[model samples]
Target: MATTPLRVYGGVTGSDRQAERRALFIESGLELLGSPDGEAALTVRGVCRQAGLANRYFYESFTDRDELATAVYDHVVNEIATTALDAVAVVQEPERKVRTGLARIVRLIADDPRRGRLLFSPFLSGTPLVHRRTESTRLFTQLLGTQARQVYGMQGSTRLELLSGFLVGGLAQTLTTWLDGELDATEPEVVEWCAEIFLATSEFPQQPGRTSIHVPDGSEP
Candidate 1:
């Protein structure tokens, strides 16, 4: 069967226009969700106004505000993760890789306080956003664990997973406080501390005592 050519209006195809609208809505979502107003700017009307689109266009891409917010959140998370992964992939030394990856995260958020607020701010902790954050944390936990194992030439173990969770969760909370202006430290300083934590946590304990930290894969959590 032959495919029909796309219908164009004012020199743009119907699909092109639709994708443009979706991108606009996502951008508006980022701006609003990260603004000082936080999730308060998540109303359909507010988002529509910010995007300069009719209310109908919002439904074209997202079912509601939460869907739009999820898209916005996913966009930020994917970009950060991809950038960090790429940064680490290029470096040969593990410490350099860790520092380089972490520096990208710190710089990205520091350069845009809006992203920092959108990500780790207490004000943005609505139930849906919280759920999404939890899911994203699990993803990062897996990524961190995999990278640590590869870098250190270690096999998967329960202890490595535990340390990864602790480091990822701890760093997120630290960034939250830092973004909230409670840390009283510079962005580089925060990156340094976090890199140290990552490096130290990546170190494996060789000895097994009566109450050792390392549990075999089948052990209880």
Candidate 2:
């Protein structure tokens, strides 16, 4: 069978106009993913319609459907991480930072149901990079490990790894539930709930027994 030449929507024409069109094409693909009528089983044709481009245009920018999906996933991840990290930047205290980060993340997901669905859903199973469990695990582990060392004064790297692994599991499960529509709270309410969990739980561990300690200023031990 003869293959048709795929034209990518907003394909680069080496001109500003082409760049603008390509941006529009990418944005349109995300919009389609978020549309009320859109399902998780998205396609090149569907994205083309959403972007108002010819089906052939999809190939001009992407090699295949999997490539397109990877682009969409990268877009969503960058957007979410940038937004959430911005919210966390001003937080000075480690505990507050963790709380604010989680709240911001949950709020982001709640605010954009489509993005939440994309991040939490299984649609990326079609893509190789996005579907790798080991990669996902490593990323989450690093995030949580940093939080532990910075916030809790976790001494050893091994300890940080163990704690981070447990914390990431909780976070991933929580996000997956939020994405699956298992929670019915407002965004702020969700944020508050997430904050409470983060603050009181071992996920963002506080100093052990320090909560009950009373050290006198004039005494030297």
Candidate 3:
């Protein structure tokens, strides 16, 4: 027997064709969400307008705006995670891995300040699915700690946790500032400076419980 087609708001279509339309809907939602005044409010009708689909098509993929918001957030987070992880994947040295990963993150933010703003928005910070950003940051922190353990024999989950949150939070705030128009530094310059600060803080030889690190001036990539 052939499988029945999935329905969006009770409208049915072939599975493959439905998936394509859903993708288009999601992409369009993201574009709208990343707009200059996007975070003010998002509605099903607004998203439908952006996606150029009938009101019914909005429900084909997402149950509501919150659902669509979650999907868009996930898409943005995945993009950042992939870029950072891929940077670390090709490096053999711990310092290089941290450097490249941090640089890649800065570059990603620089590539699209508006997208960065939405990705780092405080609105996405506390919700359940929205917490994926924090989870990803925690994972990166753990990865860095694991790397440090293998190389420097620095071992302690708490220490690593602190380091990870500190570094990721710092980077997040810095990128937020840039995206919010509070910074004047170029992307390359920002990334380079951040790498130095991050590596220095990450590898502080003796301080095992430090929570924050300082960024130095004149540090350019």
Candidate 4:
């Protein structure tokens, strides 16, 4: 009779387990931070409870509640950026591209209003998330500048950067207002208005003679 060898079940490795725990913490943070109750619900213990994770697991992945909050904020912003870019990439017409991208943003917020509140709510002011919001705006401004160059042949200029920042700031405020019930417009209307603003900015004349108006150094006109 031959002796059969016993098989060992080597389950998940330590690294794999840690990754799982980190992901759980991130998702839990998102829920707590994005809740209608807002950042008040985002304590470390609260997140661990939400994730059904031990406090030790939370510390293993994040230094503190602020770090986890930042991670959650970045996750949501990344999703918004990717979804908008992917929607625009498939279109050739400039108008359609703008419309598609803006519509995706509006629809995403509509689908999950929690994300809108998390990203844009004034209630998050003075929180670590305020820095994250500024970072997100900077990232979107860069994206807008790139899109202007690619779709409109508009080169980098001081004016273009200023306009990009202005548009990004305006858009953030508009969406925030809509999310907070301060704006009465429906989702489609909001999308259309944003697309119009974006297209108008993109169509600005870039002729050197026209746009190169002289300005005194370090002086505002």
Candidate 5:
């Protein structure tokens, strides 16, 4: 097949320029949405101004603010998830793996308070962010349950589902309060506490006749 070479404008390929603009929009979206008044600052005009791009460019990558918001949220989750997995992969001991991953996630949020607000803000209204958060929780629970089986040699069961949901939902709630300054703990304190609970929950013994129990769709990895 004869393939056409990509056309470039001003020395930038079309797709490259689009991706660059999309990246700008997402970064600006993060800035606005991660702010204390993120919800109000998320309009198309606001995002365009924040990104220093034209309004048309905003529409170029995102049909609307809600779409852009989800894009930003997905970017944030993928970044943290990738780093956490990488951190865990490097440690040999299970405790060390848990601690290392927790430290990375906690430190990431600590370093960028905006990330924390975007990911775990309790004040979020009935927005796409809330809906997406629920979906992300489900996805995370699936991954966690799968990992528990691999790391702790546990079978898929209601016990695993319960613990996974508890850990994911509990951590999100705690981080939300902590980010709001309602929790008086330091970053290390929070990470250590979570790591302890994570280990404890993962290592809990299974009850008889419950090891084969399973959640519905989205429960399996």
Candidate 6:
């Protein structure tokens, strides 16, 4: 009989084990970075200890704490983007589309307040997170621009880009404040207000077979 190659328990391969360890480290980073205590607690040794893994495993996955923090921020932002896009895609009515997307974003923070802290906390200033946040904002602005063209046949303009940037930035600050308990509104209220803002600012032209468009100048036909 031929001798079988030795394998780890449960036949887990080295690549699988490494991936598992990397996920553990990412989760640990999220816990540390997203907590109210903030990134000060996100040291490599601290994250490895939290994941119950040794420092060697952490190094195997991330070059340093900054890399790990960037990874965590990217992971959370990707999730939010996916969720909001999915929610918006299933709706055709303008108000419903806006409400669905905005509600998904709000629910993400409400479901895990830590994510809000991680994404929007002031503590993220002067770190790799700032770059990641900028990238995320650009991505979301593009998505909003695309949605505007699709839903309302609106052409891209400098003013539209500025408006989208403003909306994304304002929404981020609003959620950060609400998550930090500075805003006393309920989750539904937050979602509704955000939806209203999106609709009001869009200033889309009114047409048949379309939902009501609120023109800021009372120019709706």
For residues 125-195, write the lDDT of model 5, one tens digit per residue.
54889998888899888878887887888999988899999998898888888888999999899999999
TM-scores for every candidate against the unseen true structure: 0.87, 0.70, 0.77, 0.85, 0.87, 0.86
Clashes of 1: 0
User: How many steric clashes between backbone atoms does each model show?
Assistant: 0, 7, 1, 0, 0, 0
Error of 1 at 53 (Å): 0.7
User: On residues 44-78, what C-alpha lDDT tens digit does candidate 2 reach at each position?
Assistant: 77777877888776776787656666676677777
Candidate 6, backbone clash total? 0
- A best-first ranking of the candidates according to their TM-score comes to 1, 5, 6, 4, 3, 2
Off by over 4 Å in 6: 1-8, 204-221
Alpha carbon lDDT of each predicted model: 0.87, 0.66, 0.72, 0.86, 0.86, 0.87
Model 2, residue pairs in steric clash? 7-56, 7-57, 7-58, 8-57, 8-58, 8-60, 9-57
Model 4: residues with Cα > 4 Å off, grouped in runs: 1-11, 207-221
The digit string of per-residue lDDT tens for model 6 on 1-221 reads 99665457788977789889999998888999877678889998899999999889888778999999999988999999999999888899988999999999999889988899888888867469899888999999999988988987777887678878999999999998888789999999998988888989777543325469856887755
What lDDT does candidate 4 reach at residue 159?
Answer: 82
Candidate 2 has its poorest 10 consecutive residues by lDDT at 201-210
Judged by lDDT against the true structure, how good is candidate 1? 0.87
Q: What lDDT does model 4 reach?
A: 0.86
lDDT of 4 by residue, 1-221 (tens): 99654343377666678888899998888787778777889999899899998899898779988898888888899999999999999999989988998898888988888788888877777467888898999999999889888988889988889989999899889998888899999888998988888898876776435456676787665
Question: Of the candidates numbered 5 and 6, which has the greater lDDT value?
Answer: 6
Relative to the unseen true structure, what is the C-alpha lDDT of residue 83 in candidate 5, on a scale of 0 to 100? 88
Worst 10 residues of 4 by lDDT: 3-12
